[model samples]
Target chain A: MSWEIIKQSLPMFQQGFLLTLYLSLIGIIGSIIVGIICSLVEYFKIPVLNKILKVYIEISRNTPLLIQLFFLYYAFPAMGIKMSAQLCGIIGLIFLGGSYMSAGFSGGFNGVNKKQVESGKAIGLSRWQLARYVIFPQGFALSIPALAANIIFLIKETSIFTVIAIPELTNTALDLIGLYYNSNEYLFVLVVAYAIILIPLSIILTLLERRVRYGTFGN
Target chain B: MAHSGINVLFEGTNLTRLLLGMWTTFKIAAVAIIIGLIIGIILGILRTFHNPILRFVLRIYLEFFRIVPTVVLLFLFYYILPRQMNLHMPGTQVAMLVFSLWVAAEMSDIVRGALISVPIHQKESGLAIGLNKFQLYRYVLVPQAVQLELPATINLITRVIKTTSLLMLISVMDVVNIGQQIVEANNQKYPTGVFWIYGLIFLLYFLIDYPLSWWAGRLEKKRLEQTNGE
Candidate 1:
């Protein structure tokens, strides 16, 4: 409501925004890598790893990221494993994001046409060759929309890093409100800052989805 | 040290307190889902109609909830609403309000998708059979849609339950919050208790959510089998 509070808080919000961006970017990339490996393991029917991944996915998906962060930040230290808040935040994001992403990717992998795999096999392509030439591209393309949704979900999730004292955007806003009692202004700035980051990112992802769809299907 | 961590859980009323906190979480989620389901059904039915303005408004509502993080929304409602609107609600109520609105937005989409997926011939057949619009939906459309909607609705319920964990941020003392309190209280005496406390919270959530998810998957599979058989 007041420009004065908004003006004074912009710098802090900017710093918080950068941290959020950095955390989300790393989280997004880390999860995607984890997702790819996990999905591939499932796709190939790896024995021991497949069972472990299943349990991992179920546990990760069912629990909230906040609880996971709490366990990492608070509990791990007691168990003689020390991690900074930022590291805990990143690990939490990947831990949560990986399961969802793997679900999406595996859906794509399973949805790959049966006839295509057969044809690749008939053409004398090796297993690795078939996966490289036949499965991965189509599955990746098919997974794009789900991947985009997960990316946005991960970004929004970064808001909770405040609980671990990471000083992200939500934390900055909370801190400002605590110090100044100017809830309206700080919340307004917080919302606008998120809009600034998320709106454009969503638009870009949507565009990327469209581009991939058209590129792959020629529709 | 290993045994001490496990011992902390059974010490005093720590275990009971955690279960009570879990109950509070379930209560909030249950109330929110019920309220959200009622409103969402109406909004979803409205969305099926050819009303441009209503559709646009509903889209905005859905997008608003989709874009904003749940934590931020909780903070907005819990902190700002009392100051701006002079409404002093408890944190539990505020959490319920925000979550209900969120669930409603999500549920409406699920409902809309299920409703729209019902073939057009079913509605036309109902009209030709002397059924009025209300009866058409009640007898012909909704029953069919219910089968399609149930699995997704169950999934949404699980989502709502998981999200209720965020209520701790507003100081609603859900299971996670209680776990944190227990850990802090026992820090010196049972310094390794943190692992056990949080691990139990994690397992508790898994126990509650996994069954629902499994049920939803079974229903979805059954639906698929029925459709494929037809």
Candidate 2:
């Protein structure tokens, strides 16, 4: 709990913060790609894959992120593929985040008027063109708020990566706690790190969403 | 490239460990759900109470739980809370307390939202029928509110069960912890089964979650059908 311990550990803590940022950045990109692809398949009305993807989305979204991480980090090694805990953690977050992203995006698509699609068809847009110009643009705009929330969720979910030995913000805090063995010394500071990582990001997301929703495109 | 270094899980020799982990997972899930449901109901009602003070308290409580990550909360409860307050409690016990408090707040919000969505006409009709406010809420409001809330309620159940995995990080030896144990023990001996162990855990979760989601879907469909029929 001493200032000396906290001061000395500053660099250690920063390294962990950097790790969290790196993992979350990669995870967010991977998840958004997976989400967009899955959403397109469902929106395009793919027959069999639609059913599988629907089931995938439901199961992944309903289960906790912790369980998903554990299954990949702890259980996968037994199944024969040797995965580092960090890789397991990252992949699990991507899958979990992607599934949630798809759910929100699908809801956005559902919110779109069916006539919008028909109008695109009438304009002689190919399926890809229709999706890019007419469908996805609109759905992405509508889904932005929810998508922002999902990114926040992804940030928090990454905290659990500590259990799998990934050197992220939470693990750094826990490691610091272990070293100090004093709750007040590092615990509250860790909470601040978490808040720091999330709050501004969320605020910026909200402002950006409002801007997009109400700026020129909205008109 | 030949994969090596994980032996204990896939060799099929540690069936007992997997079963043990599975049993522990179920046990924690069962207790967590019961705790979650009762508290969730009370908190739900608390958020809607007439007292502004109570409502404010509930709002703060909800916001705190909503934004804070569960793992951080778990670490606080398991590692910090007791020490700061001078209590000596076990990890699993603290986990229950922390999760119950958190889940209650979430469930309460869901319940309140569902209750508010009930048509105003239903309340007016109840008053016209000469039912007291308490009796009206109990018989008329509660039933309809619960029916509307059931799908989300089931969803929260899955969320609670899955969250028990956090206990593993804190050394509670739940299913995930047990899986990790077997993997660590056999990592040198069998080196290849880690994937299967994880795959089983993955399938186990999907297996449990699938039916609940299906049931929620059916409940939602029935609600819609009832609405359409009306």
Candidate 3:
């Protein structure tokens, strides 16, 4: 309610916000790579790798990301594979985001027209070339909206890293509240900060979805 | 390396503790889902009503709830609400409130999508056959939209169950919290118990969620086939 508390807390919140941004950026990129690899594994039916990826995807998608973070942060250390909370959190997000993105990308991959694949073959395009040139383009275009949604979800999921004490935005807010016992003031600012980032992202995603739905692509 | 902690989860009260945690998880998730379904149906039906201001407000409500992390929402409702409003309540109750709000937002979207997907001619034909607006909705639109929305609602049910894990973060002593406690308690007894405990929790969630999701998918496919046939 008061601007004084907000003024005092601004620096901490800003730092936390930047850390969240950094984590989300890394998560988004890493997960996209993971997603593409998953889709490729599925597309080619890569023997043992495909089966492993399917189980990974199933486990990641079904279980809560909180438990996943706990497994990586708490369980790994118990097994003597120690890592920083930030690293574990980001890795968790990547795995989680990748699993969700795999679903979207597979839907897009299946949507690539059969005739298009036939035409590529008729043109003597090799299997790799057919996938790289003809298939990836249309598949990615078809899947852009779902991909954006996954990115947004990943960004939100980064908030869970606070559980492992990663000092993200939510953690920073809680820390401030702990220090000042000003839950109402700090929590309001916290929600606003999240909304400030998320609302614009959601709007952009909405526009992107509309464009993709209208068949606007690399034309 | 051998897992010295293998017996931590399987031995004695450890398994009982984990089961109790699962019971709490199931209990809370069930309450939240049922309450959420009722609230969601009402909100969803409200969303279908023709009012611009109401629609705009509902849009903002849905967008805000959908965008905010469940963890944050849990903190706000469980921690901040009591502080801000001077209305103290149990964490479990606050969790139910926050999650029901979330489920309602998600469910409204599902219902809205289903309503939109229903063919316009179906409604028109009902009107032409002398059905009043109430009769049109009751007899024609509601049935079809509910059918279309069923699988998505079931999907949301799985989501609701999964999200109940967040309650642990708020100190609600759900399955994850109980698992963590068990691991911590026995960490000294068997230094590698964390892996087994969390892995079991992960498997527990998978066992619960996978079948529901599979059923949702199957229902969706069946609905698709029926529509295609029609």
Note the B-chain TM-score for every model: 0.97, 0.90, 0.94
For each candidate, give its TM-score against the true structure: 0.93, 0.83, 0.93
lDDT of 1 by residue, B1-230 (tens): 45578889999999999999999999999999999998998888888989999999998898788888999999989988899899999999999999999999988988898899899999888999899988987888888888899998998898888888888889998998898899889988898899999999989989999999889989987886676567
lDDT of 3: 0.86
Going through the candidates in order, state the TM-score of chain A alone for each one: 0.93, 0.88, 0.92
- How does candidate 1 fare on TM-score? 0.93
Q: Evaluate candidate 3 by giving its C-alpha RMSD to the native, one decimal.
A: 2.7
Between candidates 2 and 3, the one scoring higher on lDDT is 3
Share of native interface contacts recovered by each model: 0.79, 0.60, 0.86
The parts of candidate 2 lying over 4 Å away from their true place are: A1-8, A51-59, A62-87, A113-142, A200-219, B1-13, B221-230
In candidate 3, which residue ranges exceed 4 Å CA deviation? A112-134, A216-219, B1-3, B222-230
**Candidate 3, residues A51-134: lDDT per residue as tens digits?**
999989888888998898988898898778999999998889998999888878987876676778889999999989998999
Candidate 1: DockQ?
A: 0.75
Go through the candidates in order and give the C-alpha RMSD of each one to the true structure.
2.4, 4.4, 2.7
Cα deviation of B83 in candidate 3 (Å)? 2.7
User: Candidate order by lDDT, highest to lowest?
Assistant: 1, 3, 2
**Once model 2 is optimally superposed onto the true structure by TM-score, how far is the C-alpha of residue B157 displaced, in angstroms?**
1.1
Q: Write the per-residue lDDT of candidate 3 for residues B1-230, one digit (tens) a residue.
A: 45477788776788888889889889988888888888777777778889999889888889989888888898888776776688998888888888888898888888887887789999899999999978887899879999999988988898888888888777887888888788777777788888888889999999999998889879987876675567
